[model samples]
Target: MGQIDGWEINCDMGEGFGRWKMGPDEELMKHVDVANVACGFHAGDPSTMVRTVRLAKQHGIRVGAHPGMPDLLGFGRRRMAIAPEDMYAAVLYQVGALSGILAAEGMPLNHVKPHGELYFFVQRDAAIRDAVLRAVRTFNVPIYGLPTPQMVADCERVGVELIPEFYTDIDYDSRGALVPVAESVPVSPQMIRDRILMIAITGQARSATGTTVDIPLGMGGFSICIHSDLPGALENAKAARAAVNEVKKGIRISIY
Candidate 1:
């Protein structure tokens, strides 16, 4: 087994709008280091944002913005063709709203991680990537996602912090990058635990095709992500925490 000196767990929270709620935010918060609060675009309302921010504060976790395409019907998972200008504006507006919520709660906005389709779109489209990166730079907060070569270069050129992330609750491809989920399936706590151990300790993951993929976790500059909307989110978080703690060997794990 490989060794990890330090790591942090992050989760998406506050994804409900109006009367509808999603995920066990409270329980998951206890096991994570950051909360990616959904803005009003994809999911979450003004009140939900504030409440989620408050919850993050209470749990002593950092708060980040989870901006998505305004596709609430599809939970922001559906890809939408968006103009560069519009994408920039949407990201800016959503991030600003969440920043306001954090400011009101006397908390700082730690990062900006795009949610759902918007997240993947930025990686593949240069125009959208530039727009989104430009918008994120305005806030001067780190951006969280996969550590692609282009992403690294863009973030460096734009002068924004880049925190490469690994998705433990989802499957990866031969490249060790997450493959989009087609359904909300429950990932068992044991499965999650095994995945975290492999990622944090070895800096490697098994892909869907049974290929072993390499990640940069061993190089430090990486983080773990757990999808709150996924089935068994709370259990997954617990399992991850336990696995990290075991690796830590009584030493405190620092949340970057």
Candidate 2:
């Protein structure tokens, strides 16, 4: 869609298990600018990781590492009570694994985005947040994070390039953390479009509780995240891509 109307499409891919597949990554690769390939912890195996990286390269899509807690059963959606040091080591281990795959394929990791529970943990825990930043800095790559005040400050403090992220398929609390899908958070295409436009136009989202909350929108540089686990994810992605393009053309949403 970037080619269509000057916007980029990004997707979370490579979330498959030993013999269980997840997304139509091979087909979806044709339509995105970036692919956040899962790194074994959450959902992916060695073979799946290599295949995803290779496919991403073949399609000329920017490849990124998507690391999460080691929870195959919960798919990393369940929070783990891990120590900060352990979280740091887990991140480093997963990132290293994915980096090895990318290196072997001659494609470097472009960014790192923690998945599921790890994402939520970092939103509130300073120690875990610092550990994640430290791990990312060790790899010297950009990090994708929710657009929260602490997240921004943490990224800056650690000297890691931060990409403030928005979600098209998930709803957020007044605090900016994603409301768990299990909680039956309802999100619609129009709602998502309106939220994006509001951020583009005013840099805020009216929370479910009707409170206006800041949405960083990168102050001008932001990347939207679309989770493949959502129902009708492909269609939602298409709608989001089109909506962003429309807003950019109609209102000139700046990304600087």
Candidate 3:
């Protein structure tokens, strides 16, 4: 296999607030290529956000904003029905906050990847997607999203770059939607490696319902996301990267 095929290992970091901390961000950072620093809405305060961005830069990893709804209690994973304008404002607030921090640190945001429920919502809801698109349009950064044709079309309509991202730590349904992580889906390191290999080799995935769904892999443009909050996330990411490397040596896997 040629090293031209590259994968990006990204993680959600800086999700702590006040005195409460979440996950081993520093340890996880050593294994990931990109760090999606959470804006204050869902989790993280100004101090945390700034620190996370600085740390990512020090580690030579690409930094991006991990925007979410204003649902701190649910950790921004609970679905919230809101107007398009509100959605746009919320995204702008989050992304702008991170962008400022990045600018102050002399680092630029490489992309934007919505967190938790907001991610799934935008994937299926055109109105919500448009809101996010509008907010991100003000900035010159790529939008990381699901690799669906509709999403690509939406990005094109907004004249923004779209980096279709896939998750190696999550399951997909027959319809190609992410199987909610709350559904107790079994995800192990081996299974994750298998899924990545399947996508890299076949450009598709066998869904939980035993149906083969077309995935936009090997299309010369796509990215992979591995969440840091999941159990054994670091190990799984290392394994996935090792597998990708074994199949194709000297390939540079970017984190953002």
Clashing pairs in 1: none
TM-score against native, each model: 0.92, 0.88, 0.91
Q: Write the per-residue lDDT of candidate 1 for residues 24-43, one digit (tens) a residue.
A: 99889889888899999889
lDDT of 3 by residue, 1-256 (tens): 0011257677889999878888688887887788889998889999999889888988988888899989999988998888889999999999999999999999888888899889988988999999999898888788887867788889899977777777777777887777877763667888777777777666777787878787765356566777777788778878777766654664533320
Query: Which clashing pairs does model 3 show?
Result: 33-255, 34-255
Q: For each candidate, C-alpha RMSD in Å? A: 4.6, 4.1, 4.5
Candidate 2 lDDT, tens digit per residue, 1-256?
0111124557899998888989778777765678888999989999999999989989998878899998999999997789999999999999899999999999878888899888889888999999999999988888877767788888889988877777756766787567766763666766666766776677677766778777656545667777777776676666677677777679555331
* Model 1 accuracy (lDDT, Cα): 0.84
lDDT of 3 at 176: 76
Cα lDDT computed for each candidate against the true fold: 0.84, 0.79, 0.80
Residue 43 lDDT in candidate 3: 92
> Which scores greater on lDDT, model 2 or model 3?
3
Cα lDDT, model 1, residue 19: 89
